[model samples]
Target: MKSIRKYMNLPGSLFLVTLIFAMSMTPVSASAAALRADIVQCDPNPAEIGQYVNVWIKIENIGNTRAEDVSVELIPSYPFSLDTGDDTVRNIGILSTDRHASLEYNLHVDENARPGTRSIKVRYQDDEGTAWNEETLNIWVGSGSDTFDSKGTIQLEQITIEPEVLMPGDTGTVTFTLKNTATQYSISLGGEEYDTNARIRSATLEGTDDITVKSDPYHDTGILGPGDNVELTYNIEVDDTARDGTKHLEFIVVGSSYTYNYKWDVPVKVDSAGIKVIPTKPLTIDNGVATIQFDIVNTNPNTLTSVSIRPQAEGIEFSPVEYFIGSMEPDELFTAEFDAQVVSDNISNQQELALIAQYRNGINQHETFLNDLSLTIVTEKPNSGTGLASISILLIIFVISSLVMYRHKKHQQ
Candidate 1:
C-alpha cells in the first residue's frame, strides 16, 4: 500500500510542475530590436540656404515580430534648425510594422542658418514599452563648404547692357562690377591668383562663363580687411558659326552661397556689336580717284578680332584703300586712314570705291565692309604745275622779277 501511494503522488506533482512551466513560457514582454534609420534624400539634394528641403527616412523594426505603437522624435542642433511644418518632422505618434515605412519630412532652413552636416537621434518605444535604439547619420547640405564668415565678403559686379540688338556674327564687350565686403579674400581666375587686403572684396565679371579668359599671371592674393574691389576682364568671342539669334551665358555666379546669386545676371550680349568696316576712316583720294572709309564695330561679345580690309576702286585708281583697327568695342568709334593716290591710267566721270574687312569667328570667317563709297573728282584742267610746286615756281619767278626790276630802277637812279 505504501509503494502505490508514493507513485500516485509523484505523478500528480509532475503534472503540476509541467502546467506551471507552460504558463511561465507564455510571452509577457516586447523585445526592442536595433534601430535602423536610412536617409532617403534631401531634395534639391544639396540644399541651399533659405531654401526648403524634403527629407525621407526609412525605419525598420528589424525584429522577428511586428512592432506596435512605434514613435520617433527628431531634435535639431546649431546651424540645423527646423521650420514648424505641421506634422512633417514631428512624432508619427504611433506606427506598427516588422519594417518601418518610408516617412517624408519637409523642412525649411533659414537664409541665415549655418551650412554643415546635420544628424538627428532617433528615439522610439514599442507598445510593450521596451528599450530604445538610436543611431547617427551624416547629412549633406551644399556641394561646397559654406563659409558664412566669408559670405558677402567676396562678390561680383553687376552687368548692364543697353540697346539689346545685334546682327549675326557681331562682336561686343560687356562690363561688370564686383566688390569684396569682407576684410580679406583670395581670388582665382583661369589659373591666375589675386588677393585682397581688407574685408570688402569686389570683382567684376567674376562668374562669367565661356570667356576663355586667362588671368594675368599676377593674381589678387592680397589680404582684404573690408571694402576692396578688383576689375575682371573677359575677352568675348562671337562665333561666326553661332546662330543668328540671341546668345547667352546661362550660369554666371558671384559666390557659392544662394543669397548672392545676383552674379548670374552679369551682362552678356551676343551679336550686338555694331557693323564692322574693314578699312576705317581718313581715306585720301588722289587726283581723279575715289575711295571710301571701311570700318567695323564689335557687334557681339568677342575678343579683339583681327580684320583684313580690301579696297576696290573701278574706273579710277585706289591706293589700297584698306587698313585694320585691331579691335573695337560696342558703341565705340573707329576709323582707318591711308592716302588714296590714283593710278596713271584712270578715266571715268564718277567713280566708286569699296573697302572690306574679313576674319574668322568659328568656321567660315567672313568679310564685310563699306561698299560703293562715292567720290566725284571732276577732272581738273590739265595742270600747269598746280598746287605747291606751281606756287613755288611762281614765287621764284616773282622774286627774280622783283630783284631785276629793283636792280634796273637802281641803275636808272
Candidate 2:
C-alpha cells in the first residue's frame, strides 16, 4: 500500500513539475525603447552669422515597443544660442515603433562666430523621468572668409526619354544630364573669389495625376567640377486612362541649398494610338467553315515590335491559333488570315469574336483589344438542281423504252 501511494503521488509530482516548467518557459514582454536623434535640415546651410537660423531635428524610435512620453531638448553651446522667447525642450507625447517625429528650433548665431563647423547638442527622452539620451550634430557657418563657394550654375544639358514617345499604360525611363556650365574652377563675383564647383544636393522628378514616378529621389549627388556633367535617370509610368498629347513633368535640381535650385518643365508626348484590327473580307462561315481575313494596322506614331494577333470566340474554332507579324513601322499595315469553323450548334446566327493584338513598344509589352467584331455562321442549304436532273434522266429513259416497244411490235405484225 505504501508503494502504491508513492506511485500515485509520482504522477501528481510530474504534472506539477511540468506546470512549473511551462510557467518558466513562457515569454515575458520586455520594456525596451531605442531612440535616435539627427539633424535633418538647416535652412541656409552654411548659415551666416548675426542671423537667426531654422533647424529641424528628427527623432526616431526603432524598438519593438512604443516609446511613451517622448520629448526632445536642444542644447546650444558657444557661437549659438536659442532665439529670444523660445523654449529649449519640446514635448512629443508618444512615438510608436518605427515611427518618427520632427522638431523645429530657432537659434541665433553670435555676431563674433567664425566661419567653421560647430557642433550642437540634442537630447531626447523616451519615458517620463528617464535618463536623457544625447547626440551631437554639426552645422556649417559661413562668412566672408570662407575658402570655397558654389559659384557655378547647373543646367540640364540633355534629356532622353526612352521610346521617344509614350503610349497610354506604358512605362519608360527619363534620363537627365546635369552639367556645371562654368568655364574655370574659380570665378570672381563682386570682388569676391568663389569656387566654381557645383554640388547637387538633391534631384527629384515630380509627377502629375497622369504620370507616376516610380524611382526614389536622388540625394547628395556629390560635387561636379566646372563643365562636369552627371546623368540621373528616373523610372515613370503613364496612366492607362491618360489623355493624348504632351504632358509636362517638373524636374527640380537643388544645388548647395534651397536658394540655388533649378526647375525645368520636362515634356513627354503621349500617343493613345495602337494597333487596329479591321476585317478585310466578309466574316461569314459558309457550310460550317470559312476563311477570315483582317488588316492589322499600326496606327501609333512609333514602331512596334513582336506584333501578333489572336482571335477568340466561344463555341467557334480558329486554326493557326495565332498569327505572328514580326515588326510594324508607323502607319504600317499587314493582312492576317485564319480558318474558322462552327464547332457548336448552340451558337447564335452571329457570334462575337475578340481580336486581341499584342505588341511591344520598345521593351514594354502592350495589348490592344477589338471586341466589336463578329462572325456570321451560314448553314448549308439543299440543292434543287439534283432532283431536277434526276427527273430529266427518267423522262429520257421512258422515251427510249417506248420507242423500242413500238419497233418490236411493228416487226411482229
Candidate 3:
C-alpha cells in the first residue's frame, strides 16, 4: 500500500512539472495598437530664438487592428514649449491599420534658448487599454542673432527621372542633385564671419493622385559645406489609369531655418500608349502552309527594347518559333515574318491565330496579345498539267482562226 501511494504521488508531480514547462515556453503577446511616430516635416529645423516653429509629426498605425481615440500630445521641455492659446494635445478620431495621419504643432522658442540641439517629448494614446506611448524628438535651435547665420544656400542643380518618361503602371525613380551655391567656406555679414554651411534638415517628395511615393523622407542629412553637393532619390509608382499628360509633384526641402526652405513643382510625364502589332499581309494558309507577316510598331512616346513577336495556334507550327527585333524607337516600325504550317487538318482552319508581342519599356517587360485575328485556310489549286492543257486549247483555236481568214482571202482573189 505504501509503494502504491508513492507511485500515485509521482504521477501527480510529473503532471505539475509538465504544466510549468509548457507555460514557460509560451510567447508573450504584443499590443494591438502598434503606433509609430516620425517628424516628416519641420519647416525651419534650426529654430530661431524668440520665433515660432511649425512641426508636423506623422503618426502611423502599423498594427493589424484599428487604433481608436488617437490623441497626440506635445510635451516640450526647456527652451521649447507650445505657444500661447495653442493646445498641448490634439485629438484625432481614429487611425485604421496601415494608415497614417499628420499632426501639426506650433512651438515657440525661448528668448534665452541656446544655439544647439534640444529635446522634445511626444505622447500618443490609443484605446488599447494601454494608456499612452511616448517618443523623444530632437530639434536644432539657431542663434537668434543674424551675425552667426548660415551663409551657404542649397540649390537643386539637376533633376533626373529614370526612363525620362514613365508609362502607366510603371515604377521608376526621380533623383535630385542638391548643391550648396556658396563659393567660399565662410562669409562676412555685418562685419561678422559665419561659416557657409547648409544644414539639410529634411527633404520630402509629395505625391499626387496619379502617383504614389514609396521612398521614405530624408531626415537630418547633415551639413553641406560651400560647394558640396548631395543626391536624393525617391521611388515612385504611376497609377495604371493615370491620364496621359504632365503631372506635377511637390518637392520640399528645408534648410537651416524656415527662411531657407524651398519648394518646387517637378514635372512628371505619363503616357499610357504602348506598342502596336498590325498584319501587313492577308492571314491565309494555302496548300496547308502560309507565310505570316506583321508590322511591329512602337506607338509609345519612348523607346522599347527586346522587341519580339511569337505566333501560336492550336494545330499550327511556326518557323523560327519567335521573331526577335532588337530595339525600336518611338514611332518606328519593323516587319516580322513567320512560316506557319497546319499540322492537324481537323483544327478549324478559320480559327483565330494568337500574335503575342513582347517588349521592354524602361526595364519593364510588357506583352500585348492579338488573339482575335482571323485566319483562313484555302485548298491547293488544281494540278499544273490541267492549266497547261487549257492554255494549249486556246492556242490551237487562235491558229485555226488565222488559217481560215487566210483561205477566205485566197478565194476572194
Candidate 4:
C-alpha cells in the first residue's frame, strides 16, 4: 500500500511541475513577438501654419517571433492636430521577424503654432494588444517664411512695384507673382488619376492713410499646378499731402489651404518746386533811370503756374515793377526787364532790391510766396557823359574848319 501511494504522488508532482514550466514559457513566447517603430521622414520639414503634412514611419519586427495584429498610433497634443478623424490609429497587420513596414499619416499643424521645435509621441502594439515601444519625434514649425506644402509647393514667390520711386500725388501699380514649385505627379484615387491644384482664394493690400489703393483688394486666381505661376496686379495712388519718407504696405495672400501675410516698406518722395532770381545783365543807372534785366528760374521738378515777380527798393521808383511769368514747367527759365528811378540822389552805387516770387505748385493750385529773393543795382560810370560831350565838341570844330577852307578856296578861284 505505501509503494502504490508513493508512485501516485510522484506522478501527480511531475504533472504539476510540467504545468508550471508551460506557464513560465508563455511570457517568453509573447515577449519574443515584439515591434519597434521609428520616424522615417516628415513632408514639409518645417511645417506651415494651418496646413496639412504627411508623416512616414518605418516599423520592424525586431524579435525572434512574428508579430500579428500590429498597430501604430500617434499621441496628439497642442500645435499639432490629427486630420485622420477617428482613425488616428493604424493597423499594420502582420510583421515577420527582421521584416519592415512603412506607414503614412496625414496631420495638420495649428495656425497658432509657435515657431520652434516640437515633439509628438508615437506608440506601437502587437497581437496581444500589449504596448511595445513609444517614441518621441522632434519636428520643426515655421512662421510662413520657410514653410512649404507637402509636394514642395511655394505659394508666394515674389512681389514687384512699378515706378520704383514713388512720389506724392502719383499713381502706380503693384504686382505679385504666385508660383508653385512642386514636382508634378498623379495619384489614382477611387479608380481615377487626380492631379493637385494650388488655388488662390483671395489677395488683398493694406496701406497707410498717406497711400490709397485704387484697385479692388480681392483677386481670385483659379489654380496653379507644378512649375506654374500667375501675376496679380493692383492700382495705388499717393496722397498729395503725403510727406517724404518711408511708408509701409501690407499684402495678404489667401489660398484654399493657407494664408500668408507680408509687409513691405515703400519710399515716398514729394515733388518740390523752387524759385530763383538771377540778373541776366549788368544792372546800371543812366540819367536817373536804372535798367534791370534778370532771369527767373523754376528750380524744381514740379510745374509752377501764374508766376509773377515784384521788385521793391528803398528810395527808388519802379516802372511796371511787377512782372507776370505765366506758367513755368520744371527747370524752366523766364527773362524779365524793368526800369527804375532813384528817388534820392544819395542812393549808393550798389543798391539792395527785394523781390517777391508768387506762384502755384500746380498740384493743388494754391499760391506760394517767396520773399527772400534779392538783386544788386550798380550805377553807370560818370566818365561816360564827359567822354560823349568831348566827342561832340570835336566833331563841330572839324565841320566848321572844313566849311571855311572850302569858302576860301572858292574866293581864290
Candidate 5:
C-alpha cells in the first residue's frame, strides 16, 4: 500500500493534497465537492456490525478555522476500525479551508461484539472547544454470537497486490493470503506457494528484517485448515531486465487452474509507477477533412499486449468510439490515424479524442482511461484515396500512348 501522506495543518493555508487519485501526491485543481465539508462519504449506509466497509469522503475547507482535529471513530466494541488522514486514533487534524480533500478508509466490523442496533459516527470538530459537524451511520449486529472466524478449508484463496499497475523496475509487494474458504480453521504456507504472474524482486516473511526474499513456489507450501488464515508476503521487482509495458503472473492453485492472471503495464517513464496519457491535438483541416496521426507511448515499465484506445469525439467525425493498438512492448511507440470529416458549413467546434487503455494487470485485469486525447479541427480538404488512384491511372495511360506514338514514327522514318 502506498503511504498516505500526512501533515499537521497550521491554520488557514490551503491543505489540499491527493483526494480522488487514491494517495495521489497532488490535489486536482478543479472540483465542486472540494470546497465544502460534507467531505467524507461512507458506503453501506446502514451497515452490519461485522461487515467490511469502505468510507469515501470529499473535503473542502476541512480545518477552515485551524486545521481542526478530525477523527472517524467506531463506537466502543465496534467490529472493525479504520481511517485515512490519521494513522492512529489520537488527537488528529487535517487542512481546513480553500482545500479539496478526498479520503477513503477500509474497515471491518468485529465478530465478537453482542448483536443489536448500533450507530457509527464520522465526527469533525475543531481541536479547540467549538462547534462540530458529524455524519452518523447506522449498523445492525446479530444477538449473542456463536460465530467463529471463517474456519474453513485452508485453501490458498486469494492474493492481492498493490499498485495494480506499474512501470518496469518499479518495486512493490505481492501478498498471498489464505482464506478459510472451506469449513476449516487454520491453513499453512507449506506447499507450492507461487504467484502465477509475479517474479520475486525481493520477498521477506512478515516478521523478518531482511529485504531479499527466497520464494519457493512449490517445494514447501503450507496447510490451511477450514476458516483460518495465513499469508506469505513477497517483494516484487518488475523485471528491470525485460521490455516495457504490461507483464502478468500466472498461477495454479493446488492442482486445478485458478483462472486469475496478474500483470502490470511497463510505462514509457523510467521512474513513475502508472501510465500517463500524452494527448495529441486533434486533426486540423481548413475545409471538410483532416487526417491526424497520433502516437501512444506506454509510460509503464512492463510489456503491454492488446492495449486499447477509445476515441472521445475530437470535435470531428469518428466511426468506432474505440480503436485497438495491438501488441505494444514497453516504451514502444505505436500510431493511430484518425480522419475526421468536417462539414465545411459547421467548422469551428470543440471535441475530444478520448482513449481508455485496457490490458492485463498482474492478477485480474483492469482498465485505465488515457482520458487525454488530441483535439483537432478540420480546415483542409482531404484527398480521397480512391480518387487519387484513378487520377494516377489516367495520367499513366496518356504518357504510355505518347511514348508509343513517338517510337512508331521514328521506326517508319
Candidate 6:
C-alpha cells in the first residue's frame, strides 16, 4: 500500500509541473505599448523658402499589444515654423497591432532659410504620457536662384504692343500683363485656405538709345490675389534716327520682395512717302528718231495723285510731249514711253533728255515737281531693210534731179 501511494504522488507532482509549464508559456498583457513613427511623404518636395509645405507622418503598432490614446507632436527647428495655428499635439484614439495611422501638418519655411537639407522632429506618446517614439523628417529648401520664386506666386503672362509694326518717330503703347499664379488650398493645421499677396509694387522700361519713354516710365500696381492679373501700360516714342532694324526692349517687373526682367525686340521700318524713278530701256536715236522708255515707282506709303511727266529735249521734236498717269498707289510701277524727232543739224553722239515729273504728295494735294531730270541718248545703226530702202529713195531723187538738169542744158544749147 505504501508503494502504490508513492506512484500516485509522483503522477500528481508531474501533473503540477506540466500545468506550471503551460501557464508560463501563455502571453500576458503589458501596461506599455510598442509604437513606431515614420515620415512617409512630403508634398512639393524640395520645398521653397517662405512657402507652406505639407508633411505626412505615419504611425504603426509593431508589438502584439494595442496602443491606446496616442498623440503626435511636431517640433520645428531653425528656419522652419509651424504655419498651422492649431496645437502641435494631435489625438489618435487607438492603434492595433500591425496597424498604421497617418497624420498631416502644414509648416512654413522662413524667407531667409538656408539652402540644403534640413530636419524637423516628431514625437509620439500614449495616453499615460509615456514616451513612445521620436523621429526626424528631412526637408530640402530651394535657393531661389531661378527666375520665378520657388512657390511660383508671380509670373509675366503676356506682352502686347499697339500698332504691331513701328515706324520712325512713331509713338505707341506697350502693355504688360502680370498675373498672380499662386494656388490657394485649405491647411489642415489652420483649418482655412492659405492667404498670400502677389504685389507688383513698381515697374520700369529699359531700351536702347533709339527708344524713349514718353510718359511716366514707372508704374505702381497694387496687391493682387490668387488668379488676379493687372495690366501696366507705358507710352514709348521711337526716335526719328532709329534705323530699319530690330531693337531690344526690356520690361522689368519690380516688387518690394522680388524682381523679374523680360526682354523683347521691336521692328522698325522706313517711312513710305517718296518715289523712285528708274530707266527700264536705254534711250536710242536711229534715223533722226529717238525712243525713250522708263518706269516710275511710288515708294511712299500713301497714294500719289495726278501723276504727270513732261519730256523736253533741245533740237528734238516729240510725238507725245507729256504723259498723264491717273493714280499710283504705294509700291506701284508705271511705265512711260515717248517718241521724238531730231531737228538740229549739229548733234552729239550722246544727248540729254530733260524730264519733269509732277504729283500730289497726298498731304494737302499740293503739286510737287521733280524737274531737270536728264537722260543720255546713244546713237544706234538702222536695221538692214530700213537702211537699204532709205539709200534707194536718195538715189532715185538724185537721178531725177540729174535728168532734169540734162534736159535743161540741151534746151539751152
TM per model?
0.32, 0.63, 0.69, 0.37, 0.31, 0.33
Residue lDDT tens for model 2, 288-324:
8999999999999989999999999999899889999
Question: In each prediction, how many residue pairs overlap at the backbone (N, C-alpha, C within less than 3 A)?
Answer: 68, 0, 0, 0, 97, 3
TM-score of 1: 0.32
Query: lDDT by residue for model 4 over 1-413, one digit each (tens)?
Result: 99999998998999999999999998897889777766545555556777776776777777888888888888867788886555777888988776677788777898888888788888888784575578888776767555323332446677676545455666777788878765675546578665555655456665556776667756456667778898888887777777776677666555544333233344434444467888776666666776788799987566667888888777788878789998888779999888878788677666667777776653334334544534344555567888999999999999999999999999999
Cα lDDT tens digits for candidate 5, 24-70: 52322222112233312233332335566565544445222435444
Give the better candidate number (1 or 3) by TM-score.
3
lDDT (Cα atoms) of all candidates against the true structure: 0.51, 0.86, 0.84, 0.70, 0.46, 0.67
User: How are the candidates ranked when ordered by TM-score, highest leading?
Assistant: 3, 2, 4, 6, 1, 5
Best model per TM-score: 3
Determine which window of 10 residues in candidate 3 has minimal summed lDDT.
24-33
- Say which candidate scores most in lDDT: 2
Candidate ranking (lDDT, best to worst): 2, 3, 4, 6, 1, 5
The lDDT, on a scale of 0 to 1, for candidate 6 is: 0.67
The window of 10 residues in a row where model 1 has the poorest summed lDDT is 209-218
Estimate, for each residue in 99-201, the C-alpha lDDT of model 3 and write its tens digit.
6788888888889888987988889986534568899988778775522268689999999998788988889999999999999888788898988999787
Report the lDDT tens digits of candidate 1 across residue range 69-102: 6666565544456666655234443443333556
Q: Is candidate 4 or candidate 5 better by TM-score?
A: 4
Weakest lDDT window of 10 consecutive positions for candidate 4: 256-265
Error of 1 at 409 (Å): 48
Worst 10 residues of 5 by lDDT: 201-210
| lDDT value for model 1 | 0.51
